[model samples]
Target: MKKTALITGANKGIGFEIGRQLGRKGWRVLLGIRNTLNGRDAEEKLQSLGIDAVFVKVDVADPDSIINAAEILAADGTRIDVLINNAAILEDRGTTINTPRGLLEKTLMTNTSGPFNVILAFLPLLGNGSRIINISSGLGVTADMKDYAAAYSISKAALNAVTKQFAAALAGREISVNAVCPGWVKTSMGGAGATRSVEKGAETPVWLATEADSSLTGKFFRDKKEIPF
Candidate 1:
């Protein structure tokens, strides 16, 4: 059977590129998007490239949406080999002191809690050898923490904690849970002035999804190299 991968926020940016790369490798790609129109457009684009792609309506911030997505996949009897938690929001670039409480809450709702909810809802479909990749950031690294983008940084840090927690919880089950920092890529979230291209940024996550060693779990990585969390 062909491996299947589900990527959240795959309508555009790094998430879209990850799905494209995986599809090119003959993996069944589930492109999860909040907007139905964007999801259909992405699916068509991937199909035009001869990729087997499906659109899944998912709004990561909402638990009901996540549950519904899981239900849809369950109804189809689709088992996911890889789950990429790539849907994240950068609400503000303010420092911890300057960031608003509401902004922090909103950022965590989508970036941190959203992934957790998705993981729980889809856990039944993920069996042995399943890979869970959380698209985290260097800004979340505790050793490298600065004052910039405090809300986003905090949310990702919490996500890293989630990665480690799940990795430990699922170790005996042959599941791998790891967090990846895609670097300063030029995406909608990273903006145009950013340094790295979308392909370059998507490289590590795709590798982790399809090719990384199974022993490499519960770790944080960038460019396939382990980084300090």
Candidate 2:
């Protein structure tokens, strides 16, 4: 049986690249997107490259959407070998002080609560040896730096905490749950001046998805190197 992976926000950006890489490796990749049209476009693109890709609607910010996504996947009746929680929004690209409260709440809802919503919704589809990869960022590190992007940074930090808690809870089941910090990459969100390419950014998450030993869980990784929590 081919291994299966479901990646959220995979219509484009790092999620798309990660899907392509994993699909090339022969995993049945499920590309989750909030918009069905965009998801179909991504599905078509991957299909043209001979990758086994499918699209499912998943808006991580909405609990109903997350539940529906899992229900759609449940029809397959197959276990998910990997789940990449890659959907996030950076509402305030700059100037944290000037950002509104509503923006911060929405950002937290999407960035922090979104992935956790997906995981909890799809927990039944995972089993022993399954991998859960949370796409986080280096900016989330409160101990290191905090100049701007307060909402995104704080939400990601909370995400890392969620990752740790899940890892501990699922350890006995042989499921590995960890967070991957993809460096600044050139995407719509990352912008043109970004130094890293999408391929480079997707490397760590893809690596964690396929290569890391099952024993390593609840850790932070950037390009395969474990980083301090």
Candidate 3:
């Protein structure tokens, strides 16, 4: 049977590249996009390239959307072998003490809670040997914590905690949960000045999805190597 991968926010950026790479390898790719037009466009583009790609509407911030998307897949009896939580936002431009009133909470809604809900909503689709990859960041590393993009960083740290919690909680069933820091890729969020290309950023994530050791769970990675969280 062909493997299936579901990537959140896969219409563009690293998420899209991950879907492209996986699709090229003959896996069925599901683009979890919130925008209908963009999702259809992405699917058409990938299809033109001979990739097995489909778009499923999912707004991570809304539980109803997530549940609805999950229900769609369930109705089709689809099994998600790889689930990538790649949707995130960076909305800070100042120090933490000077941060806006609802910045942290807003960021948490998308970066932290979104992934948590995604994991829960799709847990039934994942079975033994399934992989769950969370797109985290270096700013989330407690040892290297700084004030840069405080809300985004803090949310990812919380996400790392989520990864570890799920890793331990689901280990007995042979499921693996891990986080990846796709270092400063040149995307809309990373900006043009960023060092890494989209392919470089997607390398470790694709690896974790397709080639990593099944026992390697509850870890943070970058460039295919484990890093401190």
Cα lDDT of all candidates, in order?
A: 0.95, 0.92, 0.95
Q: Residue 187 lDDT in model 3? A: 97
The digit string of per-residue lDDT tens for model 3 on 74-159 reads 99999999999999888896888887899999999999999999999999999899999999999999889876779988999999
Give the Å shift of residue 113 in candidate 2: 0.7
> How are the candidates ranked when ordered by lDDT, highest leading?
3, 1, 2
lDDT-better candidate, 1 vs 2: 1
Listed per candidate, the RMSD to the true structure in angstroms reads 0.8, 0.9, 0.7
Clashes of 2: 0
Please list the residue runs of candidate 3 whose C-alpha ends up more than 4 Å from where it truly belongs after superposition: none
Candidate 3 clashing pairs? none
Model 2 scores a TM of: 0.98
The TM-score values for the models, in the order shown, are 0.98, 0.98, 0.99
Worst 10 residues of 3 by lDDT: 91-100
Candidate 2 per-residue lDDT over residues 1-229, each given as its tens digit: 8999999999999999999999999999999899989999999999999999999898999999999889878887857999999999987767778787788899989998999899999999998899999999998876876668888888999999989999999999998999989998999888999999999999999889888888999999997999987
Off by over 4 Å in 1: none
Q: Which is superior by lDDT, 2 or 3?
A: 3
